[model samples]
Target: MNSQIKKHQACYTVADYMSWPDDERLELIAGQIFDMSPAPSIKHQNITGEFYSQLKQKLKGKSCVPFIAPVDVVLSANDVVQPDVLVVCNPDKITEKNIQGAPDLIVEVLSPRTALKDLREKKLLYERSGVQEYVIIDPLEEYVQRCWLQNDGHYGASEIFGSPEALALQSLPEVELPLWEIFGLEPPEPAIIWSG
Candidate 1:
């Protein structure tokens, strides 16, 4: 755990990334190997799971297929990532090994350890790669921020949405994602038995 395959100090290739052990969770961004160790928080997992379930249900008979994390999304020779959830409409891009290109929609649930990279580095990379929609969910705030790739090849202003409000997917207008179902943490109910 102490040692990480640092990115800036050493340039890594996709082949090197492929040869890494299965236990090691890592990513390659712009030829830099980034260690994605330290698993996501419980809340992060909850949000990701619920959101993925909803997406899976919605895309059930459709061309778009939903994939959960730990699946390599090969953006390029130097850039490979594992988004929390992704929807790939192009079947050809999805091979047994990994997603060969940018997914139609990529969702990243922000955690303390990954917020900076998810919001900044990955945001830029997704936009440049022409991902149709990029969704960033803040588990702490319980809100989802969305960015759409514009006609000019740039991401437009992000639209922030919270619980009770639906997180609309620009790429797939028919799909409805209610924030409460994804990020809501309901309190436990009080004991109903009365003292007789």
Candidate 2:
């Protein structure tokens, strides 16, 4: 018997990726599909964990529900996404099936395979969707960059930060999250980096 060949499958939209039953992690960048590496990098996990801890502590009893992936975020009918950490504050937006609307905040840790798409395609989607804040953390660069969308419904200039910068999220006017925590990446040193 002769072995038959298989045809390559094509995914032309984020919706196409979302409807698949298999748990093959993937994301669409400007309608071009990219397979996600299995499990995020350890450095990425640490950063995400630190951010989640800070956010969970601060948003306690608040309306915002912070979702850690593998939660599907539908940026559009065909542009589904999964940010490392996403905050949904609008009660009507949260749903039993999915986050049906714009998230209040979104954070994604960058990897070599995903850096370009996250910085461009996803960034634009979040902006147009009225996600109030978008944060992109680079493990290699040790950088956390954020953009607080302007009232005109688009992101203005961005705020670039490093280990020393105290991350001030736009949605939480009164709270300031220290960068040292998010980038600490491990148990903090006995000595505090800076006295606030």
Q: Which candidate is the best by lDDT?
A: 1
What's the TM-score of each model vs. the native? 0.90, 0.83
Model 1, residue 123: displacement in angstroms? 0.4
lDDT of 1 by residue, 114-193 (tens): 79999999999999998999999998887789999999999999999876677779888899887877876553345589
Error of 1 at 32 (Å): 1.1
Provide C-alpha RMSD values for all models, in order. 6.4, 5.0
What lDDT would each prediction earn against the true structure? 0.87, 0.78
- Model 1 misses residue 112 by how many Å? 0.4
Residue 148 lDDT in model 2?
90
